[model samples]
Target: MTPLIEADGLGRSYQQAGEAVVALSPASLRIWPSQRIALVGRSGSGKSTLLHLLAGLDQPSCGKLAWPTLGPVESLLPEKVALVFQAPSLLDSLSVAENVALPLLMAGQGRDSAARVAFALKTFGLLALVDKLPQTLSGGQMQCVAMARAIVGQPKLILADEPTGQLDQLSAQALLDALFRHLADSECALLIATHDPVIAARMDIHWHMEHGLLSCGERTAGSV
Candidate 1:
């Protein structure tokens, strides 16, 4: 079977002060459907760079990245793939339910299709805040809403970048449980970038980044 995503010698760089600055060195990895991967690295270690490349938010400075089975990279987002950024980028003008339902709407889902939106809110424990705006919610609540939005479309893959960074330990754990449970039920692949060892421990595959280098392998026991 074709991999969900494949990167062949993928890398990214930028020109800083007329000199080339390497943000990520050429790295290769194949992400299969329904696979769970954790990307761990310190700040500026190229974790975000790699995530952006994989999400097709930014093109790699060199080499190639492809979604062999999904066809065009642009066509995959918000449908075949979803991205949850580090910060909750919810549309403030919309209510919680609207925010969660936005992706589906953008993907051509009709407004009459509220069942998917309702399910996502209830699953993420955001049902109570459905009518509320983002500004009125707590940081944890906003994060929950973001996750709800990401999964509402039932995308084949989710690319999350430090999704739980703003929450307390307890809330983070709860959110992670909900995320994994959603993925399990939907059979969706997840590639998450995180700094927490506990979060990394739960993933099946580990991608470690350091000084622009990326190395990936299956998680070893007690390696967290």
Candidate 2:
């Protein structure tokens, strides 16, 4: 089967203070459907940079990337690939329901957007807070809403960057539980960047990043 994402010697660098800073070293990997992956790394280890490159949010300075199973880079957003950041990044002006519904609306799912939004909110147990603004929700609740928004469109891949970074241990676990429940039997692959060992252990495959270099372990079941 074709991979959802494939990278060949992918890397990125930035010019800072008249010097080149390597954010990520060339790394190659394949992300197949329904694969659960843990991108384990410490802060500034280039985990986020790799994610940004995969999500097409930033252009790579070197190497190649392709979505063989999905499509061209232009067609990966709010559908084939969804990215959830450490920050909830919710629009304060929009209510919980509205925030979750934004992706569908952007994808032109006009007629069924409301129903899909409702289901997504319900999946994360945020239905009661549908009308609540971002400011009114707690940190955990905000992150749940963010994840709900991500899955509303049922993207093939979800790239999460330290999703539980801001929550307490219990809250973080709860947030992950909700996410796992929603993705339990779906074909939506997940690539979560985290420093937490507990979080990393839950994934099927492990990828490590250190000092801008990336390494991978053997793949487990449910992967291509």
Candidate 3:
């Protein structure tokens, strides 16, 4: 099968204090449809940098990245990819439902797409909070809202960074259940960057990032 995403020697760097700082070392990887990948790393380990590059939110400082499924595109399409950042990133002015619906609306889905929006909210157990604003929700509730928004558009690939960082263990488990359930239904690929060992262990494939380097390895029993 053609890979949904491909990266060849992809890397990123930034100038800080008049010296080049490598955010990600040259790394290559492929993601196919319905693949669940976990990018594990500690803070400042370049996990977010790699995810941003793969999502097409940032350009690689060197090398190449491509979405073969999208066809001849220099960058990814919004409708083809959904990214959930570490922060909730919800718009303060929009209600919870509105925020979740924003991506669909932006993708040119008409107002009749309310059913899709409702389903997403229901999936995340946020149906009652639909009318609430971001400020009214707790941090964990806000995270659920963010996840609902990411999957609402039904993007082919989801890149989530520390999605469960704010939630209690039970809420985190519920969120993961919803995510995998949706993935099983849609066959959309998921790449999540998290520091939690348990979260990484649950993914089908695990990739580790450290000091700007990336490595993919087969799952080992009780590996941390």
Give me the overall lDDT of model 3: 0.87
- Two-way TM-score contest, 2 vs 3, winner: 3
The residue-by-residue lDDT of candidate 1 on 1-224, one tens digit each, is 67989999999998889998899999999999888999998898998888888888899988989998878988887888898888669899999988888888888985664899999988878788999999999887888899998899988889999988888888889888988877776668999899988888989998889999998989987654
lDDT for each residue of candidate 3 in 1-224, tens digit (9 for 90 to 100): 89998899999999999999999999888999988888988899899899888888888999988898965543354577888988769999999988988887787885776899899999988899989999989999998998998888888899999999998888888999988887787769999898878787898888888899999776767654
Quality of model 2 by C-alpha lDDT? 0.88
Clashing residue pairs for model 1: none
Evaluate all candidate structures by whole-model CA lDDT and list the values in order: 0.87, 0.88, 0.87
Candidate 3 residue runs with Cα over 4 Å from true position: 72-77
lDDT of 2 at 35: 93
Q: Cα miss at 168, model 2 (Å)?
A: 2.1
What ranking emerges by TM-score with the best candidate at the front? 3, 1, 2
Q: Poorest 10 consecutive residues of model 3 by lDDT? A: 70-79
Which residue runs of candidate 1 sit more than 4 Å off their true CA positions? none
Task: Write the residue-wise lDDT of candidate 2 on 130-162 in tens digits.
Answer: 999999999878888888999999999999988
TM-score of 1: 0.95
What shift in Å separates residue 168 of candidate 3 from its native position after superposition? 0.8
